[model samples]
Target: MAITSANQLELLQTAEAVAREKMIDPGLVVEAMEESLARAAKSRYGAEMDIRVSIDRKTGKATFTRVRTVVDEEEIENYQAEMTVEQAKQYLEAPEIGDTFVEEIPPVELGRIAAQSAKQVILQKVREAERDRQYEEFKDKAGTIINGLVKREEYGNVIVDIGRGEAVLRRNEKIGRESYRPNDRIRVFIKDVRRETRGPQIFLSRTAPEFMAELFKMEVPEIYDGIIEIKAVARDPGSRAKIAVISYDNSIDPVGACVGMRGSRVQAVVNELQGEKIDIIPWNEDQPTFLVNALQPAEVTKVVLDDEAGKIEVVVPEEQLSLAIGRRGQNVRLASQLTNLDIDIMTEAEESARRQKEFEARTALFQEALDIDEFFAQLLVSEGFANLEEVAYVEIDELLVIDGVDEGTANELQTRAREYLEAAAKAALDAARALGAEDSLIAFEGLTAQMVEALAKDDVKTLEDFATCADWELAGGWTTVDGQRVKDDGVLEPFGVTLEEAQDMVMTARVVLGWVDPEELVAQSEEEAEEGAEEGASEAEA
Candidate 1:
């Protein structure tokens, strides 16, 4: 093959054209071309030689050069990359050991195979530059809504062309009822932009709750103006959705503003979502109030919240129960998602029945544990005494406040409560000792007599056993059995020991038995070192 000025100009022009078509920087394309030329030059100049190629931006002229570094005679290991001091002196007036030398070489004319190789190199570099450009363009657009054309469908995923690049709307992220044909325009949320080995993957989603929120933002001026803010959103794609909004301005009605006149604003979003029903509810700082608003169109009779368990029991009218818990529990499910709470919906009748059962059970417990008659137990239960601990710990003044309980009767009740608890504790301790519970285990600060008995029954009776107990064994946790998570009955369950209390008991046992965990010891040493360093700095400042 032969090369002239026209051939060099054509090569530079091809790089510029490819860069413009790929939407990458022209300078990068030229650099890639130079690298390809240098690679081809290596076949003729010897692979070990340090050959480099440069192309003029304006003239499109190509230049090739070889580079060598001057080194001491003893250090001249490679004749290609290093030149001895004696050889360097021939090329320079006074060459030092560290000086570099460059020699210009005539540009090589590519053969058929080398030209194909250079083309492949240029194509690879162009693809990389295009990927980098796509990443930079879409990385900042994550979590925002983007409009695109449906280019094609592969398997269950839709490929969308978003003007500058293409994105994939995966099967899981598409609305159930939504179907698209080629060239059909659609709006989707940019869920993520990830750079993998293949290229930048732009993941699109139509079913995300944020997609609905973004639609509302486009339709409602109040949300865009910052007067009303969306607090939370829950969506059952193509079926139902719920949004909780709060207004910073006291005068603005967030729900009304979102609904718009004749429901125009919300209807626009509904049409975009393929007729998904949306319920706009006002957000409240009070959790119960928010829950009540979330489960709308159904009147709530009562709400019982267990904060520690992160659950809420909502009692509605018997007739409203089905309404509060919509078809397949959709209403309650969406409400739970919106409020970040576990909601259990029940009828008022059910709640009443449950309360009565609890009252009877508590009354029977008092009758058996305190040796009291049914009448006395009923009186105690009516006075809101759920357990013997309340009777034993309450002030005498509090007992006097209950009807039919004079000071004398209160005193006798308190005495019986204390005596019953003491006897129970003594019985548990004797049983634990009989079952081989170590005295050290019984002496642990957080372990109750009941806990000791439970551990003794489980054969975890020694101090070593207690020290070796895993956190999950002491507190309730899930264990994998038959490829499923099964709940393990913790030793402390019967004693109503919290996870923190169980942890403290285990740590106490470990410390008493002089069992040092290496990980714990390392962490302790690091903390001590940090504290010492801070104290030294403080003393110096003083």
Candidate 2:
């Protein structure tokens, strides 16, 4: 089958056959042959040998001529040092000592070496051209999902022939241990395309976290057209996925839009996910509220964050603990990814204990009465009363000077002050339920780590019980609770960062976690610019 004995006749035929099979441009093939013959002459003869090849691809032939010096008589024959007239006429009629003669070499002599060399050059050119075509075709579809047939499988990996070339879908990327046969139809995200030794290689994925997001892109016009945005996504392939969706337009319900009436929109995604569940959670600007919703089917009471530990403590009803954590932490794991937070799910009893201790520390400032209105108290602050304690301690006569203060108001103010006093007692009970302070004051320097450890390690059941920790010693008679150090000494460390820095890190995490929001970031940058401008203007005026 290996034919090495190739001639001018065969070379021409072989070139034509290869051109037809590869469907290469006829002119390009001609250029390839012309260049190859010139190279071959340089390889066989001296570099000075002037070889010219005129290939007529239309006629399927090439004329190769090698020009040589018309030497004097002594050079060709041993008799004399230079050529005579009769000897010179054989090469050229009016030949001088350095004149050149054009001699046509038969193509038959271009055997195994020349033919193999030319074949290699031609194939190389063809491949380069093909890669350019494939690169251009798939470049536009970098973030898109395309359906392709499984061309072949090797070593538990499937190679999908995505029109131009094969894209590999590794075994790990197969959904829920899904299997596929040759020629099976499946959709895959065109994760990447690379110019490889073989050809344009497209890397495909079915289990990538973005697989569902890409499916939504195709199903929802808003996504592709830049209307509704998928902010972040977390997926457990062929099982479930939680996607935090947002919309630029306030009127549009990001979740409802993604989940069409009767679940038609999301159903398309489900099909692509191979029966995996999709939870289109509405994105919230509020982290705590968002975390609560991310862990679905579980009624979360409160969320406590430990930035030092990079952990989130979520408290749900005792009955909802198993559901919140799911079977072997599945629900919490997905929620953690969805919100880009490290979550630790806890029951309400555990959380209540944590909060109760916080209420005890803040004392009379935070109300004890459960019926005390926080909304109204905040409203009072908005009305220019900075201190409820000041209002509570004010005399009735002193209150009369105030705009809204009256006798009835003074009476209500006394009740409000009583509520504040009772809040200390109530907070103790509340803090007792919560073992650690729930979103109250983060443990500061005065607290010792051992004391916090004792509380965390203790079997003190509820926050109500915990809030009553008047003499509830952890191990030794120690009240010293070492706080998680935000920084050490005066130098800033990796963990020693400000809140603004942390927020930026979190925003970056959301991008890597799933879908990105470049526009929102741009708007934020513009707002910052305006504020900076106003500050600069005031400085100039000053």
Candidate 3:
């Protein structure tokens, strides 16, 4: 094959045809042709020479040229491609060191091997361009719903043709017992799009909670119009699910809108999910109120929430306990997910027994610590005094409010409580010192003697050690191992140190030790506050 006038126009035609077939830019194909021609030209001409080729976009005329650069006499490396500034006078009137001298050259004749090599180069370039096109088209389509046809099954994964590209749906992402064959129509959520060496990978999912939300958005006009919003979603795949929705418009009932005229809207989503039963609940700002709705069909007698711990306890009648817990604890688990809380559901009787047990335990603590009679301990517990610290530091008037207690008795009680607490603190301080704890740690503000002892037991005996500790290390945290939450016990966790408090304490220690700049900390906090305000504004607008 040769670059003759007859085949010149064919190059442009071929580029356009390939571009149309691959849905890529024709300019990319033309550039690929130019590169392939240049590579073949290099093979025919001296390999050391810089042979270049360009194809005219309109005329399709292939022009070949050999380019050489003018370099300093002492800096010349490639003799065929570079020349000294003084030796470059033949190509220019006044050649500079970095000037390029170009001369026209005839196109190379492509033999069988050279033609095959050129074809491979063009194919490789076209493939790269196709991958780039696919990535650009699908990257922003993530977190959306798309319909596709199942192409084939690879191992346990199903490959689907998603219009312009193919996506893989891992088996675990499929609804329970959902099977697909070749050419089966499937709707999937675009979970993610990633660029890799092979090409762009589009991950599809059918079991994602977002998939259900998207389905509702598509089927319900109120949701699509922003009159109602899906606040949260929790799915047990094809078995059961719960969705929380809120209405911005006062007249529009979010639950009624999602449930449709005759359960049509929700049924559409349920049909697509392989008959997954969905419980739609109204969203509320109060977590306990929201959780009560989330548990649905089961009457809750009482709700106790621990905001800091992100946990909730729901008390239901004994008959409703089984329904609230559902089959294998699925109901409560879904409720927990919907509310973003750890839920502990108990029968009314169980809650009563637990309360009684706790009351007994507190009474015993007051009895032993204050050296008071069982009646006095029970009275103290009944008066909301759980520990000696409360009994010791509370106002004398509060103790006077209790029946059969005067000012003298209140003073005596406070005296006993103070003596016991001081004795305990001294013993803990002595124990910490015996374990090699320094005064720097013991004297640190915010840490009690028991906390210092705990830190000493954990081998943290200095202010420096405390400063180097991570907040989670001091406040305790949950770690996910093999999909299970494992408790990480912190030395100060039992002392009721929250993560934020631990962070503040550690940073304070660092500041006291002169290890951190107070000014930088202030600047960082201001920057974070500005960022958070900006994010909140953007979310509100959205």
Across 139-169, the per-residue lDDT of candidate 1 in tens digits comes to 9999999999999999989999999988999
Predicted structure 3, TM vs. truth: 0.95
User: If both were scored by lDDT, which would come out higher, candidate 2 or candidate 3?
Assistant: 3
lDDT of each: 0.88, 0.66, 0.93
Q: Identify the candidate with maximal lDDT.
A: 3
Which residue runs does candidate 2 get wrong by more than 4 Å?
1-27, 47-109, 305-311, 355-542
Give each model a TM-score.
0.83, 0.56, 0.95
Q: Per-residue alpha-carbon lDDT of model 2 for 310-428, expressed as tens digits?
A: 55888788888898988767788789878767677767777777555544433333234323456544444444444455566666676566565578866776786767655654655
Write model 3 residue lDDT over 1-542, tens digit each, in one string: 99999999999999999999999999999999999999999899878999899999999999999999999898899998999987899879999989999999988899999899999999999999999999999999999999999999998999999999999999999999788999999999999999999999999999999999999999998898999999999988999999999999999899999999899988998899999999999999999999999999899999999877666899999999999999988898799889888888998899999989999999998888889899999999999887788998998999999999999999999999999899999999999999999999999999999999999999999999999999999998878787445778888988889899999999999999999999999999999999999999999999
Better of 1 and 2 by lDDT: 1
CA RMSD per model (angstroms): 6.2, 15.8, 2.0
User: How close to the true structure is residue 445 of candidate 3, measured as C-alpha lDDT?
Assistant: 99
Q: What is the lDDT of candidate 2?
A: 0.66
Better of 1 and 3 by lDDT: 3
